[model samples]
Target: MKPINRRSNAPVFWGLFGAGGMLAALFGPVLVFITGIAVPLVLILPADAMSWPRMQAFAQHWAGKGLLFVVVALFMWHAMHRILHSLHDLGVHAGTALKFACYGLALLVTMTAAWILVAVGF
Candidate 1:
């Protein structure tokens, strides 16, 4: 009989992790500093910059929906990857079950974000 071949899903998750890490490094802090803190305290960017109407309008756009979905999904996959690897150092010893749990949660969030984005309409 021919040898069996098994493919690992690690690369896909690693790719997502790298992309998300880059995104987070590049934009995450600025976003938090600007929206989470500045918008509330700085009195700089105009309070309405992140207002519901503006946000809703952005979400209603195709590009905005794509950005939102990619950001949410990639960040989630990135976080899950980190958590899975961290477990080893913490003595949790990542296993198949743990892998499933981590990746499964990422998949769930991705699906949910996609569903919501689609429902938001164009």
Candidate 2:
């Protein structure tokens, strides 16, 4: 019987993590740009008439929601990893406690985001 090699998992995990981080970094700025430019511009436009359709179109676009989800998930994942590692370094090696805290934070953020997304129709 051949022994299984668990080391192979490391590369795959790091690859996915790196790729996801890169995508998050790349899109983050674009998301910021849209929020800073498009959103404010839309809000500033006179709402008397002729701008209703544009506003509706903007609302219907999924770019904002998509960007938000990507940014948030990535940020959470990165933060959770870094924070747990830092705690471990600081001699807090209670794995169960750390896991519970991280899970709680992630769940809270996910629920809040879902509520907002649903409310915004996105």
Highest TM-score, which number?
1
lDDT score, residue 108, model 2?
Answer: 69
Off by over 4 Å in 1: 1-7
- Using lDDT, give the best candidate's number: 1
- What range of 10 consecutive residues in model 2 has the weakest lDDT sum? 8-17
For candidate 1, write residues 16-116 as lDDT tens digits.
99999998888789878987898888567887888999988999999999888888988899999999999989999988899999999999999999999
* Shift of residue 22 alpha carbon in model 1, Å: 1.0
For residues 1-122, write the lDDT of model 2, one tens digit per residue. Answer: 77886555445334534655787678768666565665666665344323566545544468756655556755665566557667889998846777678756855676776566557663
Clashing pairs in model 1, backbone N/Cα/C closer than 3 A: none
lDDT of 2: 0.61
lDDT of each: 0.90, 0.61
